[model samples]
Target: MNIDFTLEKYKTLCETISNSSYTTFTFEQYFNQENPPKNCILLRHDVDRNISNAHKMAMIEQRLNLVSTYYCRTTERVFKPEYFQEIAAMGHEIGYHYETLDKAKGDVEEAIKIFGQELNAFREFINIKTVCMHGNPFSPWLNSNIWNKYDFRDFGIIGEPYLSLDYKDVIYLTDTGRTWADKNIRVKDVIKDKDHQKNNLLIGNISTTDDIINLIKEEQYPRICLLAHPDRWHGHLIDWTGELILQNLKNIGKAGIIWYRKNKN
Candidate 1:
């Protein structure tokens, strides 16, 4: 396991911000700065954990004088009233991480019908104004198909960022493929820049956590979108490592299935 430059880069970025311009009072000004600071850390949490890694991550960010958004899933392994309230109290943004397609299992109508129920339920705990789709990595479908049928804003969601904008305007980064550049994974759904302005939409593959840290240091502050699975990042290294292993195994299985089908034909 060579050094994960992605994580190291992120750490460096955080440290640079802390030393050069970190302040309890200035935090507000920092984000609003017109020139932009070169890097904005969009720490996103896909709340899929059995334990409370989201809570711990929030605590860590708080210690660093940073705040992030946490998107909670409201299904099988989902949103609890107590957990929702706790995250809200931390003064962080709470949004929806939905998978109605998975819940509906390819039935578009069924997904929409259930989405209404889930949306109503989520409102009981928090006023969720924004949403992001839970990328069902194993599914052939990209984002939950239900999102394609209707406008989330009508359901009181301000935006589902991924579907709402072109990635070129703001760089799209995520912990997808267990590392950024999972070559086998081609995200066909998310819009990419066709103008060849790769720098503007720097969606490069990040193989290590250090990639994130490094970006925080070098780039000019551009609003970034990051996807993290709380279910994947357990506080302990052992648990985190195990989750990655399982994810890799699932990917392997998917590849094997593809290979078998190709040979059988």
Candidate 2:
């Protein structure tokens, strides 16, 4: 039971809202609607693998009687046309997972050009509307990695949640570097104002898996969107927990190196 907690935690969170008998459902069916049900689980998947971990997460959500949105990168390493049709077949919303700034690597102008090109490529297979940043931690820019280079709304995009949400009001949760709320690196999907700035783009951070469960228990907010990487949640306990632990370790080590170099100078 102790060993099973990590795997059980995410599953339990899914089951609680889906259960209905134990807890009632509270999610608005549309975006930006006032009087939202309470907690809307926007299960997001960022794909970079040839085979999608997002697909597996979608399957788990299906078991819980839920659906989610998946954002796949159009880069050579992550591109797969056949899988697009299959994922769309599963009834999940398909989106573009973009890392244009990283693609440009400090050239904001080139990043914009590449973003438009990538956007064009993604539309070839699926009807994509929403987008989420790939969270390229090493990049100096966050959402601006792509958006700062260009206006996504001009491309017919409805909303890019990472940029659109004010984190102060909506609680922001992500599986970046495979941990819950990490303090060291730059997180791309930060819509929250942690300083308690009201009227700004607000998003709260959930530091632990237990925090997520407790929120469901307490019925904290009216709207919440969880950003998860398909690469993080592969469904199997060994793989999921292993990835989370290993990735966070890598991030910690990277932070140590940066700190050492900064102080050495």
Candidate 3:
């Protein structure tokens, strides 16, 4: 099989979706639509680390006339105002990929406060209508937990995928752990919808970008939210190879952590 996580494959995947019967929409567009199209794709990118990679993906999608939502973390390195503005200018939605709880060290009040600050900061670049949690695997705290004490809706946010979207309606597929089938390394990216699991929907059935394209061609699901991390898809040989090596090391560490937690419980 050819290399799957390359920019060529990524562009092919986008082209497949673009050529399909399904219409692609940004998360904000999908959420605001009174009557969404029957077969649709909500293309979302979680900009966890590399802003440049996210920008590249955004440009590709824009050239294809496809819009996607990009959730950016407010870390010093990842939060680039110019890049965010560029993505928004390309007609992509910009959202906050918040990890305030972990940053707050599990203080709910502090987390909520920090979240507001970060959200406001991001707004200076683009109008952020949605927010997504950044699951810090090493932290004991889940960033989504901040909502348990305070609602994001209060902050003018319309949606948070993990909290807002019904998995029963939209099939959630994420490239966590570098492969769609590997659930062990995923910390908070999994969906908890029982119906989705019982039906054996798209979870374990997909492994590569090609698998996703085939499924779309078959019209396997009514709607899908394809979550991709830009850092994983690189065109340059050195950068791509480096990411592969780094992810492998990270995966081993994540596996160890998962095993320790399972055994402890």
lDDT of each: 0.60, 0.62, 0.85
Model 3 Cα lDDT, one tens digit per residue, 97-133? 9999998999999988898898889887679999999
**What lDDT, from 0 to 1, does candidate 2 have?**
0.62
Q: Considering summed lDDT, which 10 consecutive residues are worst modelled in model 3?
A: 196-205
TM-scores, all candidates, are 0.76, 0.77, 0.95
In the range 135-172, model 2's lDDT, one tens digit per residue, is 66455655454565477889887667667554555555
TM-score of 1: 0.76
TM-score, predicted candidate 3 vs. hidden true structure: 0.95
Q: Which candidate is the best by lDDT?
A: 3
For model 2 the local lDDT of residue 138 reads: 54
The runs of at least 3 residues in candidate 1 whose Cα sits more than 4 Å from the true structure, single-residue gaps closed, are: 1-39, 142-144, 186-197, 200-205, 254-265
Residues forming the 10-long window of minimal summed lDDT in candidate 1: 22-31
Which pairs, if any, clash in model 3?
none
TM-score winner, 2 or 3: 3
